[model samples]
Target: MPDLLVEHHGVQVLVCSADGATIATEQDALDHLVGAAFQGAELVAVPAGRFDDRFYDLSSGVAGAILQKLANYRVRLAVVGDISHHMGTGTALRDLVREANRGRDIWFVTDLNELTTRLAPRP
Candidate 1:
């Protein structure tokens, strides 16, 4: 199925439904952002599998570039699915996820419920 917009926590999110497609480059990331923009989506949800294995390698620069593009476009990004295993690959990647999760612009969540909570209002 193609990307579709869904409301979660009252936020319009464009979900990338392309299963098994590896988003390994900045262009691939940009494509999703563009699709979201076109759909007037305020946020984006992408499955963890959408990202290539290299994205976990901090030195590869894939993750940084993708996240940067999302920020540049003012689009919130949520990487959905369990990435706890990937967290053990290296300190840089683990630190990156930790830092991103601490902010509002981007997040790495284990499931859709966590994604909603992450985007929900905090008091």
Candidate 2:
């Protein structure tokens, strides 16, 4: 299945299929970013399963590189799916998820419903 364009609360989101290409490198991240931007998407919703395992390992720097690139391009991102397995006790991944969620630029949500709620208009 290919990535899809969807709308939630008036926000255009590029929702990547869970079975789509695995994002394991900065180039892969850029590919998604470019595609989303081309489609005029305000955000990119990527399933957690679409990411490579290295993405969950903070030391690998894959997450930071991908996220920073997206932020630099002013592209919002929502990682949609449970990532609890990656968040072990005292893990940097957990801290990263917490910090990212506090901002509008990036988020780690459990599902599309959560993403929808997050995309709802703010008062």
Who wins the TM-score comparison? 2
TM-score of each: 0.89, 0.93
- Per-residue lDDT of 96 in model 1: 85
Q: What is the TM-score (0 to 1) of candidate 2?
A: 0.93
Can you tell me which runs of candidate 1 are displaced by over 4 Å? 18-20
Candidate 1, clashing residue pairs? none
Each prediction's whole-model lDDT (CA): 0.81, 0.87
The C-alpha stretches of model 2 lying farther than 4 A from their native spots are none
Q: Can you give the lDDT of residue 25 in candidate 2? A: 88
Error of 1 at 122 (Å): 2.0
